[model samples]
Target chain A: MYGESKSGMQCAEFDLLMTDAIDGLLTGDQLSRFEQHKTACPTCSAMFAEAEAGLHWLGQLEEVDPPVNLARNIVLATSGLANEGARASLRSVVNTTPGRPLWDRMRDAFSPRTIWDHVRGTARAIFSPMATPRFAMSAGMAFFSLSMVFTVSGVKISDLRNLDLTPRNLTRTYYATEARAVKYYENIRLVYEIESRVRELRRAASTSSVEPEQENKQKNKQDQKSPKENEQRQYQNFSRQDSASVVIATFDPGESVIGESARQRRKL
Target chain B: MEDAQVVELLVRRCIAGDAAAWEEIVQRFNRRIYNICYRFAGSPTDAEDLTQDVFIKVYRTMASYDGERASFNTWITTVTRNLLVDHFRKTKNDRITDSIDAAPGESEDALPLSDRLEDTGPAPDAHLERRETRELVQAALQKLSPELREAVILRDLQDMDYKEIAQALRVPEGTVKSRINRGRAELARLLQRTYRQVM
Candidate 1:
């Protein structure tokens, strides 16, 4: 009903009122207003019709005959839950009920003990060396956090291999400024790498010049078909011999086995 | 015995740890709860699982039930609806990936309650149209947002009056009314789009 009335209602409001009217929810003044509005407005009339049709369509949706075994399956699945509840009230009249079950009392007697045992077992296993899932998760998280802390401290995990971890060195490391120690380690490591490279190059030069006869003998013993392949093999042998350095930093007792991959990268 | 009296007796027995009484309670509400779960889940397997879980939860929380607060039906509806809301939340991502055409298996059991209700009465083309409309309506119902869909299901499909819906949803009567109105309009639009071709 689009008629200009003394009390002007918005189109949305009228539409909503029409919905209520269709449901027979609008009574008295509300119903009176909606009837007047819909007669005047074709849109409102359509709205009422649409609402009515929708409700009709929905109403046509009937109570489906439930699946045949649904109740049985539910009863089976929820029996344990029901028993849990039953256990709480078992001291009361349920104990007198016919067909009183055994599992309920068994569960009541042992469940807390079992649950407590599990909790205690979990607590004991968490920090132990034998890896449980929860323990592994914690260990992994600890490793990640420690790695992040080491990275932020400018002490890469690889750097621990180079630091001398003796009592005297440990004290120096403990007392040293973090930035100063890191800078010193970086420069000294660079110098060590250069010296190692120089030593390898000198060894290569001496071998080629001084051991020409020996090189020839080796070449004769090995395959001499490809000059390119021979050269590549010589370079690879030199690299493998010098790649990994055992810097052996004792900053952390746990990192004793790790070699300096940083120094290894410069070997090529 | 009236449903209320039966419910009261069952609740008392269930609380008293009477397993038989609990089974009887499950028998009473299983069908009603399954239908509600089916409306929300859109698949029989999921509906059955949800229904089982819902009853389990109801049994666990049976001790807290206060008849003064709400009738057993209203209280149980609230519990079922809350569980559905939580389930929808958990499965929202997975549900988004599913195609609209990937409708669940439409076994006789999976069909809308209306289809089954009218099966005995309708004849020929009327039966076919009703079946078709029922399927379309169900699909459309699934398309609505959870709030709107629940409101429509409770108010229109389940024939719950506004007061019951408000009590079940824990919303004000006015909010329930508006949600029903919006849901109906959306459902109508969906049906109109679908029926434009068939009708």
Candidate 2:
């Protein structure tokens, strides 16, 4: 009880109202009583004045701005605790499951509640940033595109489950791959042969047409030669042409034999 | 929603293991807590460390919070105060009680605290630079006992009301007021005796 004494406002009463007086909260009768007490008592008056000055100095002591990393450090520290707490809680839950038959416990392990909790936790941990609707939609579209590719590639999920990895099957697969590669190489070689033959025929026709006089001279020389020698010369010329075609096919299969022949004819 | 309701929801979210909610709580209160620590510990580095320790304690014990009993602000202030008191107890023996006659920088030729001050009471119009006043006040505040120091800090510097300060200190309202009165008187005396001109 801080009632006024017979002495009229003791030091205790003055101390009681000091804060309110300094804050200007005292008014009317209380204000009058406080002012009278302050004037009547030197100790109370000095204490009151000093308190006001103390408040003034405190007002000057501005709030010290925290370091810039304070909030970040706090968050990092607490978030680590939160994660540990979550893990601890999970362990507690798992540990507290009532003892039961292994089979029953196993069944309960797959229970919807347990599964849902695990799924929710995993989602929070792994996909928290991807929880947006836009991200979900993008994820769904990507899954659908992957499914389409699998279907087009004839890759059934069942087929994946039943894949044949036996040695015999592996051997068959290896031979099949080898056969396919050989067939591809043969096709390329056939194309090269056809192109080279066409170029040779075109060159032969062009040479005869462009230099008939030279061809006639060659024919006369052939006529003058013995038949056996002429046959030997023809065989030698055929062998040289065959060797050139083989060299072109081996060294640069993609080079155009027709372009080469045209350049050769121009030089001749 | 009102601010009280918003804070209540945040508390619920934090209890539900929402890290972002906890982060928001830290963002809202870190500066206040740091300032309280700064006033009590008398150094920024110590204040920073104590602020972190306070939050860590709060985080671990958040489940014990009862909203119906007190606001988050009061509870956090209580946590910060408790941590500061604990730290003081730990480092109490290490603190050097400098003699009043000791010179600045401990040099013999330098002026003592009492000799360096201007011989005048603080004028209503007397204006010390903000930084100078802050340094003078902080020095005076550090001279008070922990009990009195905390009272004035929460009351005047922190702007907490009597009820909030009482709750944070776990003391009666009357005791809070009495300590605040004594604390302020002592602080004023310290400042007036030493840095009288800067008041």
Candidate 3:
């Protein structure tokens, strides 16, 4: 019942009136109206009471002593006086020199790192474009080279004059005859070496008198027989090598044939 | 020197990078700044740190000072209030409790009568029952929202006018009034609760 007018005074409006009352700003008719509203509203009355208490409490908050060294520390931090040792050192150096320029004094006050930062900023601003130009030029050349390679390789310019017969049938004939010739020559060479080695071992076994020597000669003939066995192994290895080489050569021939066809188209 | 003369001298010395002038300035204002910080933060240690930070900020920004705009005290108080508000926003849950301990061996009854009188009339304690009631009132104040508390502190404790309080708080005078009223109401409820608890 006491706060019935609370709905009439919007919260914001009530708060404003309350503030005005605290500040002694409300007067005449406005003051009378607020008093009437407060007498009827428990909420507004409570707010006024709270405001009074808060003010009283704020007044009672005692001023505490600041830390003893607070002023000293603040002065040290703000005035750059903390670097007295560095300053003293610089002063001694300046004293040794009879007279120094104003710029030198200024430089002495600034730390090397600060100067370096300024120099680095200036250098970046002045030379940044020059530093990247080489890389930019290289990139441009690479792009140009790529485009030229693609254009030359992509365009089909062929001559009819360079076109030979298909020659696919002729390739098989030539490969077979070449392979037979190589195999025949290799076999004849291997047979000749084996027959000569057998004759040498038979003569050595017949001439030796001691049994140990004869046994040695027999071991020699057995060792000599290993060569003929190795020749057979070599023949097998050669056959594998020859087949691989033939496939590679055939692939190469096919590539050349494509190139020849391209030339022939251009001629035509 | 008068406060204005002192501020002018300190400002000149500070601009000239005089270390001693800066120290004197800190010593003069530290207590007032700390109290403001304490009222805002409700913690002694936080208040002390904040007071130091306020001084540091004042020193750094002294170059921006123009005497025509405001007095040095008003500028500093404004800075302290703004910093505290920013701090309050960051730590939304931090409530500033009035933790003023009673001075050792001090009793209300033993005190002189003149000490208890306000300019208006009998002191606040004349109507209240006991010294403990003051404590209860303080505790209730801690329960008020920050906006309300700030308004009350600025208007009542700091004795800033409504317009000045509004300006310091960067709010309309109407908004300031509303916050103060609501803050007062909340505090009264809290005090009532405390009174009941004590009973």
Candidate 4:
């Protein structure tokens, strides 16, 4: 966009002029020249337009409110410093008040050894244990769980290395992809079972063909079966995206192996 | 109170451990100082800490004030500028930028300065666009060099004239004006680029 102009003004010069114009720093002569150049040059016009647009946006910046309690916290900190200053001044006055010789006072005030000794004393006092910890009776009793008495055998390094070290959350990746395949095959199995049930009902219906009411009774009983009800609940949970998968996942936590209910048709 | 009288009164009382005077002093200049810090730090998160540090430094060095010379506002701003420059120097590795510093034409991946702005309350979509404009301008300000950034902020945001900015920044008026102009142009370029991406 930095093209030269017939008015002897460079685009870069026009860029600076754009700001000068906005800031009202340009003289009448310069402003007139800029106008002539802007009208004559595409690059200068585009640059002027861009700068104007940017300045327009910048002008819209609102004054941000300071965070809540900033003033209070600053005052509190300032007060702490003031208090410390007052005490220091009082100490200095006491040191310099005609009680001691000038050299001796200076020694006390600026002596490195004295300052180090004071620092050491403060450090020792701070780090010294003030009291031995004593637990309340209730806390002691609560800590004594029966489970604590039953210890498991210690795991050797080799034993631990033999087992999977990945976290359960990481193992979830394995379950996600594998679960779909398990569901697909289980659906096929369920479809086959339904077909078989229908065939059996047909055969029975042929025998009971004399009474249509008997066939209806068998259909109603099949609808109320636990597996059918369980499937319906599972379908609803899947559609709503509830934690039914998590519940199924926790049924066997040793691994993230899932869809066992699907394969076995368990009434979960 | 006049600037000198206020400084003298507050300084005396604060030295004597008057919490009230300190509170008043903080309340008076806190917003101005915060705005400066916000501009310099280029983000809200660092502004509060930077402002607190400036105040603490002011308190610690309270013994060095001379109310007979420069006004308190001048002195405090000088202190702030010194601290801010030092801070920027020390944290040279810690780049203060919005997503604009990414590779060219990668605007899709780069989040606009607007997305990073907090405290934009439940406003209409129009208000949100204005806020975005504000943030993009600030992001553009971040693109300038420190000298230019300081000059532009002092000139535009702080509304300091050429002479005052020159005095504050300890530079020639010509240099200050040059920096301000160049800074404005760069800011405009960045703001314009981002505006198109945003729209």
Candidate 5:
């Protein structure tokens, strides 16, 4: 691919020089050198001929018309993009435009009524005393008065010397005397004895009633032939006992004794 | 309108966001820009797309235009050349192929020489021969490298002088002349080959 070189122009340089020669751009010394090289070099000569022929041929090509819609399409596309930009810009302008008057802004800054109201509110908040302590004192007084009324209504003072004394009455009188005296003393001994006796009686009653109630429930269950029926019978017995206990607790002593005798007869 | 006046008005309206003026600008240069793009892309469709792209680029960068440096035509041509070179680099997979055809709307009697003759008309055979010669020239022009192609298109097709071509291409005048010469020689060889093939 090497060609004749002249005046420091190699093959590639020679080609460039030959192009320059064809284009009539080479200067005095370069022009003479290029001409000498072309005269001696067949490749440079051919290249020059080819370059001329090519330029001549290029001069002949017809300039074709583009598509008819080309300009219209471009305009449409660019217009669409531009219109969108314009709309965005317009929106920004509208958003940024001042909506309020200068007087309105000034009035808002220095309104006298609002300043006075704020000052009044601050003064009230700083100086005003809370009513919670006074309300609490009133409530305490009402509570103390209610308690005094209840205590005075519930208490009665009888003559202390009228308590009775015969052998059976002496035993009752002694118990009454002991009961009155017991209120004055610590009386741990009597209270302990009463508690122990009540506990013993409760244990005995529970032990005696549990077996009978269970036996009755079992018998009722056997008669009914179902556990649910036995449970219902047990619940009925418990309800009867609960009602009787309530009646006994609510009755006067004389009525209670009579009711107990009647209950004992019924049991018998 | 005078070219300078039209350019000035269009530039003013374009800056003012006048779409109609922008469209007139596009219409005015569409053919010329398309021709430049066609010379680079060697396909009408690609050329059309590239021309549209060039105008879009021009519109975007118009704000940066400093009128002191270059004429509008030279600026646009430079934009087109740079865009085409970028397109060539991006789409290296598809080679550009040029096919010769008659200019659109140009009849047989409307050949360049015939038009120059001032006879108002010419014989059909002369026009056809002129068209054939034009096609041969175009086929030859397609054989050049991008730089040489740019030089030839600017010099011969666009009918710009070496100085203008050099200014458009940002090259020395001597370099532009050398490129044109090399490009023309390559184009001649291509034309001969094509002629031989046709024969």
Candidate 6:
């Protein structure tokens, strides 16, 4: 489709090179090839004509004069040395009034404080969008949730002020934190082990009582089988019992052996 | 010192907490940036607000400007282009298509479209024609896609060189030229369709 024309340039090539030609970047053979292609192809010629006309019209679209107060407004907004907004009267006073006292101008316009204000104003503007109600609400909710979590864990704001700062005390505090974490983990592990043992005991007592009649019938049946077959049946029965115990464990009540231990200690 | 040096000195003063230098910077670029915004947004009001926003951003990020990497012009233009793109993204949903019936520019200097239509008195003098042409071209420009619109605006309207435009637009020089070419062709066809007599 992009086969070369008599001008040694394809239409697609002409289209690609047209921008350079319009920009006057093409010279020598490139320029000649482009011109020859444009002359030969009506479509490319029309396109080139349109682009030229467009560039000319655009060139005539002279730059518009900014609003009179635009500069004043920008200065007021950026500088923060004065009130912002299009307060034309104030802007005129700040912008047009000539012969302000040198000291006054220096203090108002050149002072480091004004620069600080400018910096502050810019920073504020950049962050203004982030100060939306939704963001504020989200932040407040986060803070409230954090405070609630801290309160539930027995952490107090006041406790932060009473912390010891000496190096010796700091080392002791670090070790204390480590010891407390280890103790908490160990307590959790002990509770888990106790819960599992109590669950196994409960399951053993319930199965022994509820299925004694079935077990007796199985024992009578096992007496008629070969010894090897009887042994396999026994192993299968043990495996089924272990699976039943696991199923019961999943439905175990929230009450743990820890509560029973406290009860026993009270009785003691 | 050259203009670039002067701008560099001004930027140094600005970075050093010179309020006067900041004001000077704003004054120098306000019209240029305002015009760019006006052409890009197709609204004088939005342009004014955008110009203020651009200057605010420039003030905030002045410390980051590097004269060694780009001239002040290119740097400021890049800043303006970025803000305009951001503005475009934000207002993409809210943008209403511009009808030729709507007033063009809506600034003090620009005559309303209705006023131009009613100017039955003598085939509008050169000043009026030029103003009408400006408004027509602006309206035509609003019809271009943002990519093409920005390319043409930076090249033909702002008169930035292609290299500076490439830097500001963060595109290859060839891509920039291609966009400008397409933008010009589209704009010309649009103007020819609408204001054939004027063109």
Per-residue lDDT tens digits for candidate 4, residues A1-268, read 4656657776656665676687677888788888888888886676567556655655776667777877777777765555443434534444444657989888766677545544654554454333324435545665564335433445344664667647884588678769988999999999999999999999997887757778888888887797888999989877454355556666785745455435334544
Q: What is the C-alpha local distance difference test score of candidate 3?
A: 0.63
| Predictions' DockQ, in order | 0.41, 0.33, 0.24, 0.20, 0.26, 0.31
* TM-score, every prediction: 0.56, 0.57, 0.47, 0.50, 0.48, 0.57
The residue-by-residue lDDT of candidate 5 on A205-251, one tens digit each, is 99998998999999987877777777889989977886676577557
Q: Note the clash tally of each candidate.
A: 10, 0, 19, 0, 11, 0
Model 3: residues with Cα > 4 Å off, grouped in runs? A1-14, A23-25, A40-42, A56-62, A65-69, A77-268, B5-9, B89-142
Residue range A1-268, candidate 1, lDDT tens digits: 3434523555667755654676678888877776777777776666667667778778766666667888788777766444332444333333334344777655644576445544554555453454558878888999999989988989876876887979998777777778688999999999999999999999998987877788788888666667778889999886666542443333436554344454455554
Q: Which ten-residue region of model 3 chain A has the weakest summed lDDT?
A: A81-90
Residue-by-residue lDDT tens digits, candidate 6, A1-268? 3344748888767766877787789999989988988888887788889888889989878777788988887887765533222122222234223467766766666556555555666676567657889889988999999999999999999998998899999999999999999999999999999999999999999998879789888988878777889789999997686556555555658755555445444554
Q: What share of the true interface contacts does candidate 4 keep?
A: 0.35
Error of 2 at B116 (Å): 7.4
Q: Ranking under lDDT, best-scoring first?
A: 2, 6, 1, 5, 4, 3
Worst 10 residues of 5 chain A by lDDT: A87-96
The global C-alpha lDDT for each of the candidates, from Candidate 1 onward, is 0.72, 0.79, 0.63, 0.68, 0.69, 0.78
Q: Is candidate 2 or candidate 5 better by DockQ?
A: 2
Q: Write the per-residue lDDT of candidate 5 for residues B1-199, one digit (tens) a residue.
A: 8896678678657755677788988888889999888876666778889988998888766655544577778888889999999998898766534333323223333443223323335545876668646544554455567898898888778888776788789998778867877777767766566566554
**DockQ winner among the candidates?**
1
Tens-digit lDDT track of model 2 for A1-268: 3334523677797898898888889999888888888887778889998998888888877776788999998888776556543533343344334555777767766777667666666666666658779999999999999999999999998988888999999999999999999999999999999999999999999987889788899989888887889789999997687657655755666666676655555554
TM-score of 5: 0.48
Q: Poorest 10 consecutive residues of model 1 chain A by lDDT?
A: A89-98
Candidate with maximal lDDT: 2
